[model samples]
Every structure is written in structure tokens, then in C-alpha cells.
Target: MKKIIILLLAVVAFSFKTKAQTFHVPENYTLKEKADYGKYEDDVIKGIDWLQDTPWPLEEQKRMETNVFLMKWIQGSPTVSIEINGSVAKMTEKNPQLLMTFMGGYTKYALQNKTAFDKNKANQAGVKAVIDKYVVETDHKNNSLLNKLTKIDKDGKLADWMTSDFNKTK
Candidate 1:
């Protein structure tokens, strides 16, 4: 009886220790631990492409850079590729994550210098058109997708000051 009780206690302690081994996720994934998570960024890029292909007014790089949410990615230094509707006609060499960065950088560069192709024209023009189309579609249909975006500007008034809701009493 004494030997059995001691053995049971030892098993319980060992089980507790096994269960206490906590998982360790990498820092880039969580910024809390230091584990080598390897390359997971490719999936992120693929996911962005998924977002881009969807009908969310995914404009060309040019216009997206100006938007603050998208701008954050650009400022971070990811490369951008511009596909017209679906064909791969141009790219920014930085990676898709920096589409806005490339867009913003290219726009700034064009403003300072004059080049004909390789993003001089298509990047800026494509981004602007896509963004404009997105905004119009969002407004005309009363889209919730851009509702957060609509409230971003400081004036708030500029987003759509002339709307009927703007003058509502409530």
C-alpha cells in the first residue's frame, strides 16, 4: 500500500511537468518570443494577392499609397507589382507588400525625374483609376467595406460632406 501511493504521486508529478511545457511562437509572428519560425512572409504576400483580386476596389499602387492604412505597408519597404485587371504588365521590384511604398516612391521619383516606362506612367495612372473607381462604387452602393476608411480624414467633412446623413438631425 505505501509503495503504490508513492508511485502514484510520482506519475502525477511527471504528468504535471509534461503539461507545463508551454509553446514558443517566434517574435516576428508575435514579438513575444525568440524562436526561428522560418519564412512565413510568402503566405502573407499570397493573402494580399487574394485581397487584391477580390472586388474591393483594389486600385493600382499609385492611389493606394496615399491612403494611410495602405501607406503603412509602403513605408515599410515591400516591393509592389501592378497587374492590369489580371495580366502582369509591370512591377516595382520591391515585393507586393510595398505596393504603396513603390507607388509612393515612384510617384515622388516621377515628380523629380521623367522616365517613359517601367512604372513611370502605368503605376501612377493605374493606382489612381482603381482607387477612384473603388471610392465611387463604395459610395454609390453604400458599402460598409470603406466605412472605416470614410472616417479616416481629420475634417471628416471632406469624406462626404454633401451626403444626406451629414445634415440629419440625429
Candidate 2:
């Protein structure tokens, strides 16, 4: 019985490990001209799961790339945005900093396309509400990220970049 239980546990653990490894952004992935929410649904869900379960990628380039990709995927439609927002909201206990990373992507995306982003009232409002919720729910005492988020919430913008001059560097 003990051996059988151990074997089952090992199998379950291995399956989870393999599942986590399966959903990374592909190297050839480029932002498509049009957002296809239906086509990328599974990838978006798995990517969010990975973000919630895994630590932020340590490499600067990899981190920024993943963040940008996630932002693009999640913002494909209002439905996708809601799903991603709910997942990130639940990350407050595990790693609230993920919210910062997610927002950083939004900032980068805006910088990349200022005109379109500025015109998108829905996107702007959604980002604002998320930032406000994060600031209210988390402790901001000496937490630089949370403090930054508070400012973003107030200003109705999120431009905190982990990398200096992301546009030039990339």
C-alpha cells in the first residue's frame, strides 16, 4: 500500500511538472495584426497558470518578453482581459508583484502604440480599475511596487518599467 501510494504521488507530481513546462511563449511568436481570442484561448489560460505558479523570470530580456506576450494575449478581448484579471487578483497572497509585471507590459504596449492605446477607452478604464484594486487590497508600506501602482492609479497611467528605455533597448 505504501509503495502504491508513493507511485501514485510521483505520477501526479510528474504530470503537473510536465504540464507547467508546456505553455511558454514560442520563440517565433510575434504580435498578430488582429487579436484572435478563440485561437489563443488555451495558450492564454496556460500562460496565466504558469505566471501564477512560477516565480517571475529572472532574466531581464526573458521577463520583458514574457510580460509583453501575456499582455498581448490577455488584451485580445474583454473576455480574455476579465479572465486574466481575475487570475492576477488571486495572486495577491502568492506574489502580488506579478501585478506589477503585468502592468509593466501594459505600459510598454501603450508606449509602443500611443495613439491607439489612448483612443481605447475600455482598455484605459480596465487598467485603471485593476491598479486601483491592487493598491487598495495590498499593503503599500515601504512597498515600492505598490506605491508606484498607487501613483499609476491616481494618474490613470501605468509606465513603470523594469528595464530602462524598453523601447530603445528592444
Each candidate's root-mean-square deviation in Å? Answer: 20.5, 12.5
Candidate 2: where is the Cα deviation over 4 Å?
A: 35-38, 53-64, 76-94, 98-170
Model 1: per-residue Cα lDDT over 1-170, one tens digit each = 99999999999877644433321212234212222111323333332333333333433342242244333332343233333321112221212333443344343333334343456344444343333334544323443422433453234442243232322322
- What local distance difference test score does each model get? 0.36, 0.49
Cα miss at 78, model 1 (Å)?
Answer: 6.5
Per lDDT, the best of the predicted structures is 2
Runs in model 1 deviating more than 4 A are 1-41, 55-72, 78-117, 121-170
lDDT assessment of candidate 2: 0.49
How do the residues 1-170 of candidate 2 rate in per-residue lDDT, one tens digit apiece? 99999999999988867765666665565445454544555555555445434434333454465566767765554432332333234433354454654453344344445456652343343344444445544333344444565575467455432122212321
lDDT of 2 at 84: 38
Residue 88 shift from truth in candidate 2, angstroms:
8.3
